[model samples]
Target chain A: MKKKILVIGAGSDVAQALSRLRAERGHILWLTARSQEALQPLLADLKVRYQVEALGFVYDAELHSAEDLMAQLPGIPDEVHVAMGYLGNPDRLDDPKDAARILKVNFSAAVLLMNAVMHAMIEKQVKGVLVGISSVAGERGRKSNFLYGAAKAGFSTYLDGLRNAGFSHGIHVMTVKPGFIRSKMTAGLPLPGPLTASPQQVASAIIKGMKKGRGTVYVLPVWSLIMLLIRNIPDVVFKRLNL
Target chain B: MGTPMSALTKISNWGNYPRIEADVRPWPLQTESPQIARGMGRCYGDSALSTHIVDTRSLNHFLDFDAESGLLTVEAGLTFDEILQVCVPRGWFLPVTPGTRFVTAGGALASDVHGKNHHAEGSFSDHVRWFDLLTASGEICRCSRTENTELFYLTLGGMGLTGIIKALAFYLKPIETAYIRQHTLRCENLDETMAGLEAYGHWTNSVAWLDCMAGGRAFGRSILMLGESAKQSELTQAQSLNPLKVHSTKGIPFPIDMPSFTLNRFTVQAFNQVYFHKHPKGSRDSVVHYEPFYYPLDKVLGWNRIYGKRGFTQYQLVIPHADARKGLQEVLELLAKRKMSSFLTVLKIFGEQSENYLRFPKAGFTLTLDFGISASLWPFLNELDGVVERYGGRLYLTKDVRMNPDFFRRTYPMAQEFMEKIKALDPTGKFQSLQSQRLGIHA
Candidate 1:
């Protein structure tokens, strides 16, 4: 069945790929972002290049719950994708207001919006799927970016519980733990190709994981084995070595 | 029909085995209700709380047996007892036997049960060849890893929520006799148990019983048991025979539900001490009966009755193998500090990756404890749930009755896929259970 889909972070590279994949799959799509006007050229190109039913809505995960965003829509789409994430500089989060702002936008707001959409799908018992973009840094806290890690950790755990809550119901929850992504999220960071995934690779992997009913997935399957090795590093050595 | 909820009908535990203060009335069977499977009643909670619990005891009939291939086909309701009745006599046995034999074939498949040998053979789901599932639409479809693979995976450890299992076919393990060649190793503490079991896993089917009540120096101390089926030649002339099954004759019914204070620490400690001592020294070599070895608790017809009218709960959790020793220490330390004495506590080693993302048993160390019901228990269990979450571990749904939605989700991340598959099958959600509702599985 061709689904009426909505991409929440339309301009993001991952979001664009997801939009492309769904569009190619013949889904009727409505893409949303912080600047629909900014995304107009991309939107027009998408309609022309992908030939998908496409449109765009402006959204700020900081300001609006997904339901409010969807409420603005002509009607609800079959599935919603939250491709928004911020690996903000933890060092700059020293100011109390700054830290709280990061927490609100990065963690609280995203959770609220995603959950609102989840509540609707679950209550309607609709055959809907919700995918949250999370990072492997959320697996365990690190001194480098514990704040961002904490936010992703909370979001990842929320997605996990949401999955369990929707089990007997029709709702589906997925926790995507991409090891390292080459996107605005990690633009200039020097990352080894073997350890990192491109935005397109991540989007494809996430779709595959959701289709397989995988509860938790590492974007690069190799991360499963890699994480296994990291998880077993004993505390004595782990405490001394800084990753 | 809903279990008649009378003020008199106070239930604290979900196991068919009894504790102190309660009476277990069999749930009335209804034909019109969707097809159903019966669990061992060991589900400590509500995984088996279905509208129509097909009291699998009636379906305990073996349909066919291939002696050479060790493949046995039987009615879904067949229990481990019936399998042993036929297989033990003919040098064959079910590939995997969970802690208790009281569970039915459908029950085992529904829960995707794991046993002491899980590290070696995976779970019961791995051995199952195929099954006849009675879907909500009333279609009897054959599913296995090959046919209807999705249904097969979903049904395995699917918690009987997917469909009513009618009959199942699985390969059996060839056994020399009904006896097991046992080995006993005493670990001074939990870490040693992990090390000892891992070192010996390749050579044996293993399990351990921890001394949860023992505090301080003895905290996390346990006895590790590693064994494989004994060869037929290992049985002596006296052990070579079979005895007629004698049903428990005495019905020691709890005339009246006892007060909650009845199963206090004093009585529980006494029971724990006796249970711990009964295992004898470090180890002993003897030809033990399959009934005693596999299903000792089943001998007591109404064992759960001992817990009184207010039932108890079984809290089981699995920590990643790397952190098992530390996690087990924390759990035991907490239980000891609480002074909660449980009579039955079992520990098993798990290897191989957990297949079902949301299903409970995985590659790690799993701890199972039977605790008497107390008002403080839920809060305490919730606290333990937090501990499990920190370690990225989860509780077994089959044994869980009190985990909240957040805790449950943190525990089983793959629940979404199972949810989707089930939704695809039953859109209207006609097949519903109290557990699915309580855990928000069908909210």
Candidate 2:
């Protein structure tokens, strides 16, 4: 049976990649991004290339309340994927406005958007999955991107709590932690080739996590071990090294 | 939830030149219309390039088939290789295909690609029955020769500006064997090669490997290959093992981009010299799998990287039969005079005319010259475009990158009508590719 999946940020390459794999097996997709003008071509392309029903909406997650955004969707999605993230230039955090903007987009906006989806699923008694794509950077606080990492850490903790709450309600919550993906976010960075995974590789893990009903997942299973090693380091020792 | 995980990265087509920083999103199976469709990025130029591209490689799927009627329905993203994998085992094959099977159905239809057997089998446009096109307005318009007839013509080689093709149904050629019986002839000079090609024009499939480096009286030395689909009785022992199975060549990838100087004129000239001498004035008849017969270059996986990081451009032009000899002579002379050498040189004859607008073939002889991308390539190609324009021929859009609007309009007689048709389908002018923008097609 095809699952009615709603992708909150269809413009993201990870969401697009995940949908590409699932839709081929007859998954129904509902796409909502910041702009229909930008995501519409993707919907049209998917409909043509996969011959699947891909509906897209111009949804501004930051601007609209979750309930208002829910009104735009047709029904309670069987699966909801919140794959939106924001990382402001680390060097440009001189102004308080930049800090607020990043926090609003990354943390507050995501919670508002997913809360509406959670309420709708509970109302409809939908027994399905809620997936969120976080980053492995959230595992530890580093000076280079500690703020963005803090926001993701907060979201990961929120998902862990959501997983506990959803377990009693017949809903599953999965938090995806992708490390050093070769995406637009890390396009030009001189990251180690062996350590980096492509969006497709990350997307595949997300799907696996959903199917297995796992609470949290690292994109490449190897990243899980790497994160474990990083997490066990004492703060006194970890703070000395620039990550 | 909104996903902002899209990463912008630099990607290029097969030529590996003109790499651009593009926001490559995965193909959203369900969403609004994407700006452009990019298949395997097999096109040698900017024709398939876009800053914001919907990757079509993931959409690849073989949907339906009818062995009795030889009708195959496939998603636009399905590659020729996938199609052949299924159909060849069922005694069916694509009626028309390009030199490489890596191309997706949508890419082939968009370019109206032709094969070595073009004189007999024609182009992809001729074999297609109909296709489901997702327009800019997000409507799935069923297009065919009889239905939505206007768009049908324009979309055939329309460069995909009409819409994103969703699915297409086409007729396939049924075969009893997967082998092609070929007869090879070695020609001593330009006149002999042309004469040999003419003699084999009626063969089911034929092509020539010309040594463009040959100068003076020894010019146009070539090996002319002529073939016909092997009958059941003519199948070789290896082919009969699994008559319908598709054969795959062992691929050794070019691990890294070769240095630009690796394939310079001196190297190409020497290579051509060796190739020219390899085959003397003789003939050989052999039976082989259809894969190698149609897609010889496919044997060399990632061979384009041999041209180095700048990539290469394939300049293909077809001139009227009347001017073929002189035009070819001039083309070769220009290359030799400028010391511009081509690593891969091909010559063939096109038959009849296509009803579809923007189709490149006519009753003429065609030549393909492959030049590794270099700093001086544009000016050299511009002069060659002048040569083509003077002789009344046009470039293949599939491999073109630098042709100007004036030359395009002059060479293709149906440019105005084609533009009008594209505008009719795309009234809001939504779809635009790098090639269309460069040629001022949208304006």
In DockQ terms, which candidate is top? 2
For candidate 2, write residues B35-89 as lDDT tens digits: 5678888888888776577766655555566667888877788899877876787
**Weakest 10 consecutive residues of candidate 2 chain B by summed lDDT:** B26-35
lDDT on C-alpha atoms for all candidate structures: 0.71, 0.81
Per-residue CA lDDT of model 1 for B1-443, tens digit only, reads 00122212223325532322222222223345442355455567766555444444444445566777887777676677656654665667778887667678888888778887889988888888989887877788899878988888788888877777877889998766777777777776667767877888885588888777766665666788777777767777777664222223244444554565767677766666676677665666666656666666666656676666666778888888877777877777777777666667788877775555457777888888877666787777877777777777888877777778767765787787778778889776655555776777676
The reply for model 1, stretches above 4 Å from the true place, is A1-243, B1-13, B16-36, B39-42, B51-58, B241-262, B274-282
Query: lDDT of model 2 at residue B376?
Result: 89
Minimal lDDT window, size 10, model 2 chain A: A183-192
Superposed Cα RMSD, model 2: 7.6
lDDT winner: 2
User: In candidate 2, what are the lDDT values of residues A1-243, reduced to their tens digit?
Assistant: 888999887767788788878787788998888886667656755664456898887777567767777887888899999888777666445867767766766677787777777877887899879998888878887777777888888888888888888887799999999888766555435566777888898888888888888888887778889889999999999989867
